[model samples]
Target: MLSFARAEGAMGAFSASGTLAVMLDRNAAVILVNEPAERLFGRDLWVTGRHLACADKNATDALRRAFHVLLRNPTPPAMLNPVPLPRLGGRPLLAYPTRLPRITTKAHPVR
Candidate 1:
């Protein structure tokens, strides 16, 4: 499981790399997301009941496949290519799934 400390580290890596990050669970539900990622949601993309969603039908279909690959990949590479999130306007966002370390951190309970 990706601990909160690892999540923070992942977020830092994402920021340094100029990429927005979204972490999903095995069932494809949104576990957590960085601020930059939440801002990416507007017209083309948004969270539909804790899952990433797309306004465009084609993009939605594409995201479904990407999510499957992301969730079910058995090998270590996780994903060989970044999943392309198509937007109605502006450049498409490339999503890369990463595994965070297991180190834990104390924090307030989820309210």
Candidate 2:
């Protein structure tokens, strides 16, 4: 899995193939490069801290709802159902959610 760490932001770990992945943080932002994903959806100009839905109203609303699902589940979700991007003047892409591992607060002992 792609292990990325941002001390003040979030962590998204995906496999080498990039098929199965997980995103954890207050922001539900991501970067994608599929032809359809790029053509239908907008790209993050800054390359960071930008979600595809920010510019698209429909994606924004759907993403908001997906966040709600995470909010309701304190234990974190086991899986994220796919969310289709708005197509009719909407973000033209499909987003699928995959559950991330539970974060544990264990400390490593120094020898």
Candidate 3:
């Protein structure tokens, strides 16, 4: 599992390398995104707090299913092929989901 710091480092490398990349938390929320990704998605604003499912309304169901499968499986899949990104007429992009180290807290009062 990738730690938060490691994930951030990875994102930096990816950004420097001009690779389109995004890091999502276990809950499938956008945690980090690179420049190429921003251009590809056509947005310059920070998307860290947004959920991936809501990022692309056209691919909501597909994104939800993909995230669900990744979350449920112990191992990451080779790739989530042909993920439709919210772009000009919805372009398909290959997606890879990496598991991040689960953050545990003591406050377990409510769900």
Task: Judging by TM-score against the true structure, name the best candidate.
Answer: 1
Candidate 2, 1-111: lDDT as tens digits: 223333212322233333333344546555334332333333421123554454456666776688667745677676577776545453444566554453434566989
Better of 1 and 3 by lDDT: 1
TM-score, predicted candidate 2 vs. hidden true structure: 0.50
Q: After superposition, how far is residue 29 of candidate 1 from its true place, in Å?
A: 0.7
Residue-wise lDDT of candidate 1 within 1-111, one digit each (tens)? 447567677777877787778877678888777887878888878888888887677766677677776557665453536667777787877666554433465677998
lDDT of 3 by residue, 5-91 (tens): 677777788889877787777677787777777775544123433865435565666766787777777776745655555544544
User: What residue pairs clash in candidate 1, if any at all?
Assistant: none
By summed lDDT, the worst window of 10 consecutive residues in model 3 runs over 40-49
Best-to-worst order by lDDT is 1, 3, 2
Q: Tell me model 2's lDDT, rounded to 2 decimals.
A: 0.48
Model 2 Cα displacement at 14 (Å)? 3.3
Off by over 4 Å in 2: 1-15, 20-24, 27-50, 87-91, 103-105
Better of 1 and 2 by lDDT: 1
lDDT of 3 at 102: 47
TM-scores for every candidate against the unseen true structure: 0.69, 0.50, 0.61
